[model samples]
Target chain A: MTTAKSQRTVFFVSDRTGITAELLGKTLLTQFPGIEFLKRTFPFVDSVDKAKSVLAKIHDTAQKEDRPPIVFSTLINEEVRAALASDRALIIDLFADFIRRLETELGQESTHALGLSHGIGDELVYQKRMDALNYTLSHDDGMHTANYDRADVILVGVSRTGKTPTCLYLAMQYGICAANYPLTPDDFNELALPKPLQPQRAKLHGLTIQPERLAKIRHERKPESRYASLENCQGEIRAAEALLRQAHIPILDTSSMSIEEIAISILYGTGLIKRVKT
Target chain B: MTTAKSQRTVFFVSDRTGITAELLGKTLLTQFPGIEFLKRTFPFVDSVDKAKSVLAKIHDTAQKEDRPPIVFSTLINEEVRAALASDRALIIDLFADFIRRLETELGQESTHALGLSHGIGDELVYQKRMDALNYTLSHDDGMHTANYDRADVILVGVSRTGKTPTCLYLAMQYGICAANYPLTPDDFNELALPKPLQPQRAKLHGLTIQPERLAKIRHERKPESRYASLENCQGEIRAAEALLRQAHIPILDTSSMSIEEIAISILYGTGLIKRVKT
Candidate 1:
């Protein structure tokens, strides 16, 4: 059995994808550590009936738990937002709280539009993002080096040190074309920059992880293999770091960072954020 | 020269990745269609010195433009936030506005942690997301049908109907293991579910696009080829729609939708969001 004070139901409601509401709500919720928040998201809730149903669900959960729920909403439609009003829950309407101030500051009436954030705002921008995704995919893992000139940033790292996901994240989130090259055991033996990366020195950034963590990650894919040995992991990382440092390339230790953090760090370290429109 | 009222500079400042601030700020700015916002983001502004530099940059831009810049910040540190304060711009501090209300409601003090939102929260959750990304990558474009049983959702669509990016987005954002199969001419002739997909009927979702849009997209990849012809696009889309209808698979038309929108709609259509923890 759970106590009412320790357990809470939270809802993220929005007219569109509810991504902003979820992101902000989750960030705020992370502040309180002990409470367990069971989250539910209601996306595309653009109608009064949908909002009313969400309100009913909130009330039902409150009744069952003997405590009120918390609702983080980005509902732009007035009637639909009104339908979700309830005294039983802590309703934080994000847009309603900020839009009025923005209107007053900007000295204009807001369009009161729905789902503009996730919509295809500019056709050229959307196309560029799609193109960037394709570029990153085709250039993944040193698959195509002919297009290295087009890459915004090229990541050099040992396998399982977080390269592919970070590249994909850069392309997906910022529409930046990123390519990655995996440093192999053979390259470690030579302790020199890979031939293909030599010409793209200015775009190169290195990622290295702790040897224990690298071994664990590699062991997940290939258990008990020589490649997953801690000694091998340590040797490879040492060689890779030496080569990257010799070349004067910036390196990021990704042992404790998320993909978002790694991507953002690369963007800032390489000064590529200046070129990224998003 | 652009009028001062018609153009304004916008800045997204944060102690971490600045993604949440940019997302929420952009959503708010979209309401004012006539104004053009030149945007910049300053991530990792955790120190007072860094925040002061950003403030100076904002003031410089304001002076050059003869209009105050709009600053959207998610800085959690009080000293850093205070250093960023200035009368030259409209600074909308997201954390400052809502954290107080949340603290009052929860009856608890916030950890006031820097970069918690984008940080690697739980090791298991982070591992799941990385595993999901690896799964989606390996299953891309029907590469590994042997793992269809493990997929959360299998997307079937003709080439260039926005399958690959949508799959990547679902995996990266929601940690959903999405697999996509590109429907070819042979599949259209059979008008039956692919052999590998027959057992995974419950996980199947279909994507369609307007013939003109499909033609344009194909043309971008392989210009002047028969694959980019309008006749071929129309034939493929019609056959794909008919086949999906026969299978009773839910379909989404991706003519004007963004990748985020397409991904969210698919999650809702397939009820996969229930399985996704994040």
Candidate 2:
């Protein structure tokens, strides 16, 4: 080896939107090996000061090292771009570099082409899927549960019980159309499926959380609300469980499991669908 | 090997609150092999009907294939649990499955301890990153050239030139605060960096999109606007490139690239950062 692994350094920079960039960029980096990369996250794309500091560092490294340094920057502004353009090292501008090329090849005449999206499919499929989602989100009833009539499954739970995020995830990440609902204390006592739910009970599934877990989740938003109180939380949980048990409904306690686990379990138990990759 | 090469199946399910269930579920799935696992997603958990269908299917499958299924259900509802309690299969409930264990391990009363978050990291760091981005967007003062400060890099280009999207992508995806500004008609007419941007000329990088491509992009957004007309787009692109060339600014033509490719290129070129494993 030329030197100790620790001696080699690397950096990462981005504009105002830094979180998603890191998530995707970092995920993609796993393919490389051997060299040690030092990570520095840069947020904000509007400062000459930051660019100057980066430039000075680049110059310093150029004189001291035999091996060239690598810098990855996602420059979004021309001034910002001017602030860091240099010959000292390799620079990557995630947005500018790619967009220019994309414009040339795809924007030549506006074929009305839709770009690929992460609704997780290739461009065409992704567009179609997202279009479907937009329709569902906009046209679905106030419950946000229309065309859910076509759903292989539907989910219902209580407030802050992890419904919306899961539904969108299933639809986007795996292309599942999931609908959700919150159970009120009144529903627990009366016990036929809630009003709108009775008609769809055939596909209905419920997610219940521990009173403590529910309280913990609610506390983050409003610690003092009755919704987050231990006593109130416990009462609702117990009553709900009793009603569900008497009715013999299938349930999953979601206080601990992540979203993927829940979806997998349903697929296994219901035999609704499967991802083709695996 | 039972029927060699059978894919393992994973599902996500939730009733009441599929949000937490889905959020956690998708994150967990990222850990598995896509090629080896078949993932299915379901949302909205009402246990009664969904479970009955599941039971019937499992019964049919067992009677025919003589094998019970391996299912990872989130079963958040007590009713769902009670109903499926008799199933002869491997079953799991995410909530019931992990709560008590965590309580014992944490040595805290589950009821009072409620501040756990799903995402891992520091909130302050995230906030700082966001603050930088907001600052970059609000002010486009061109002081980056001379005593340029606080910018990793700047991007320059004409209006409708993919600056905003590119900048946002970089900031959100990479935590790289990228600032972008349009090369207004005035900049083209004057053919010089704005006063504020003049000092940081060395660090500035230019984005050049082909005229035809620019026209196409503008057309899609505003088919009838004068700016979207190909003739105008062509005129602006040619003039912008000339000005950039005169200033000796390094330029990237983003005409045909995916966001991933663009980001990777910037990271590679800038010598600012390196890749990381997910």
Candidate 3:
């Protein structure tokens, strides 16, 4: 590929939120590390007119960039998908490609529905997700210790070790009721599980971070505080790891992991993936 | 398909979290409403041995169910993918199909690396997502109104209208700093935008829910309270709608929309999609 062609515009178009298209498209793009993708998302393009307008935009981008754009689409409507057919852009329709093979395999025609993926498909499942979110919120950072019995998994970690966001992500994405407790200096002094978490030991998963990263995160939150000092971070991490090891709790290093990676690791380690509804 | 063949086991297999495979797989499955899919996810199957184990599990499930299973995979390693090939199950390798096409179009060879999709690819972008999550948490439910200047979008609605989760989802998924404020009975009295939100009028988006649904959600949280009464919910909805209309803020009815739907609606309506990093 020429140097100019290495920079291309990529569009993720979908009849719904376009999250699936964007995720799959971006994942594919990551394989080619040499290219720089200028990304855009056209969501809720459920009609022929909308598809036409998006195609026009893609055409404009191709003309402006002197290179054809790459389009990843999940448009379910046949007419809308047909309207988006452009020779100038390399359009990869995710659903159209897979649905044909699936139909041949299943011996059934697809519904071609617009928004079933992200739609509220099952009422009870949707309610359960919302319930999990509410439960996670009320129990964040050890706020409601009495509710530990209802939690699918309880995360034990130091502050800013990514406890809150992981709990919230588990609830939002997988409908898992994840509660987190931030281990403090007092708890580490004893090198034991907190009293309230003893009965829930089987559900406990620990997160530890490198002292340098922990200090950096803390310093961003509380500049110039002792809590953000490298020495204090090192002491807390050492004590926390010792306590987790003593209790036989599975531990994950969150130093370079993203929130999604951390959540998935905890779920797999604790056998909580079985509890995920969707 | 025969009635006995309506039920089939589906497996989402991946080298990393299996999130992309599951999401895309489930979305495709939604097209066939008549078939009942029993789904399982096998994440972090990065090696040949792990792939063999998962295939063994899949074979066992197929035999137990008296039918072949459907497997959707995003395994990037060629040897690992080859190991998972089985006649007992219909394996759909998502990356294998697309990467070939992408390679042909881009004239580049894919890295075929594992875990790049959910991994921390760019440090600055990953940190920004965490920053967005922290910002959303601190500004949740009208807290830290002083920091409204830093928000990408401000969601205004009554309690239990799906504001908090939507805000968190926007932050977590898109790295958009979203803040939410709950309109109380006091604000309904004047039918005015809250005083703190006056200067940030352009950043405002409103969420409204059906009275019946609102009452049901509230009753689940606070049963037998006057706050959960349908009549009270009706009055609040009417007043909040009037206030939002008077303020000219865009309104989204959350009666049937999922959190993803609501967040996308708000982002598109407020033109905040441009600010989304990923």
**What are the runs in model 2 whose C-alpha is more than 4 Å off?**
A1-124, A135-146, A243-249, A260-270, A275-278, B1-278
TM-score of 3: 0.96
* Every candidate's TM-score, chain A alone: 0.95, 0.55, 0.95
lDDT of candidate 3 over B144-221, digit per residue (tens):
999999999999999999999999999988888999999999997776788999999988899999999999999999
- Candidate 1 structure quality by residue, lDDT tens digits, A39-123: 9889899999999999999999989988789999998888999999999999988888688877777777788888688878778
Chain B, TM-score, each prediction? 0.94, 0.55, 0.95
Most lDDT-accurate candidate: 3
Specify the CAPRI tier of model 2.
Answer: incorrect
Q: How accurate locally, in lDDT, is each candidate?
A: 0.89, 0.53, 0.89
lDDT digits (tens) for residues B35-132 of candidate 2: 23444444544567776666565456545645443344445456765665535543445445243433232233233111122221234443344444
Q: Sorted on DockQ, highest at the top, how do the candidates line up?
A: 3, 1, 2
- Per residue, candidate 3 scores C-alpha lDDT tens digits across A137-226 of 999998989989999999998888999989998998888898999999999768679999999998999999999999999998899899
**Whole-model lDDT for model 3 versus the true structure?**
0.89
On the 0 to 100 scale, the lDDT of residue B121 in model 3 is 74
**For model 1, how does the per-residue alpha-carbon lDDT over B19-40 read when each residue is reduced to its tens digit?**
8999999999998887778888
Q: Number of the top candidate by DockQ? A: 3
Clashes of each: 0, 165, 0
